[model samples]
Target: MKMKKVQEILEAHIWAGEEDLEGEVYAACGCDLMSDVLAFAKEKVLLLTGLVNPQVIRTAEMLDIRAIVFVRGKEPSKEMIEMANHKGMIILSTQEPLYMACGKLYAAGLMCESED
Candidate 1:
């Protein structure tokens, strides 16, 4: 799915990297464990995480994740947003829980690495 459509589907607020929202996201991975993200996430995927910190941004950069959806209204720190912006990673926040957000996006045709 396109990042814009994912934002709409999740009723997300774009917190950073707004200019890059038009890009495509072939898959998604929802997890709070940074190790799991680093181990499994593929390129151009959207990361849905609740762990709000600079390390989340760092993980996304390492995986070449195209976007991040902060679940259950979790917000990123200033440094995290700045890092995401610099890496061209679109950041979004939603009130939905991580599982719900992931399900909604999956139904909308976004899958995880395993599903693909």
Candidate 2:
């Protein structure tokens, strides 16, 4: 799915990398555990998490994830945003909780890596 569509599906607000809104993501993963992300996320995946920390950005970077959706109204820190911007990754935040956000994206045809 296009990042813009994902944003719309989740009612998300872009926090950084607005230029990446047109990018494509083949899969989505909702996880608070970075280890789970490392183990399962594929290239260009959309990461949905409620954890607000710099480590999230680092994990996404290592996995080549281009977009991240912060659920439950969680916001990334200034340093995290800067790190994401430096890495050219798009960051989005939504008021919905993690499960609901993931479901909405899935219903919109954005499947998980395993489903893909």
Q: Count the backbone clashes (under 3 Å) in each candidate.
A: 0, 0
Once fitted onto the true fold, the runs of candidate 1 whose alpha carbons sit more than 4 angstroms away are none
Give TM-scores for every candidate, taking all chains together and pairing residue i with residue i: 0.96, 0.97
Model 2 lDDT tens row, 26-84? 98899999999999888878999999999999999998898999999999999999999
Against the true structure, candidate 1 has what lDDT? 0.88
In model 2, which runs have C-alpha deviations exceeding 4 angstroms?
none
lDDT at 71, model 1 = 97
Q: What are the lDDT figures for the candidates, one per model? A: 0.88, 0.92
What does candidate 1's lDDT look like per residue over 6-105, in tens digits? 9999999999978877899888899999999999888878899899999898888877787899999998888888888888789999999999999999
Ten-residue segment with the worst summed lDDT in candidate 1?
Answer: 107-116
TM-score of decoy 2: 0.97
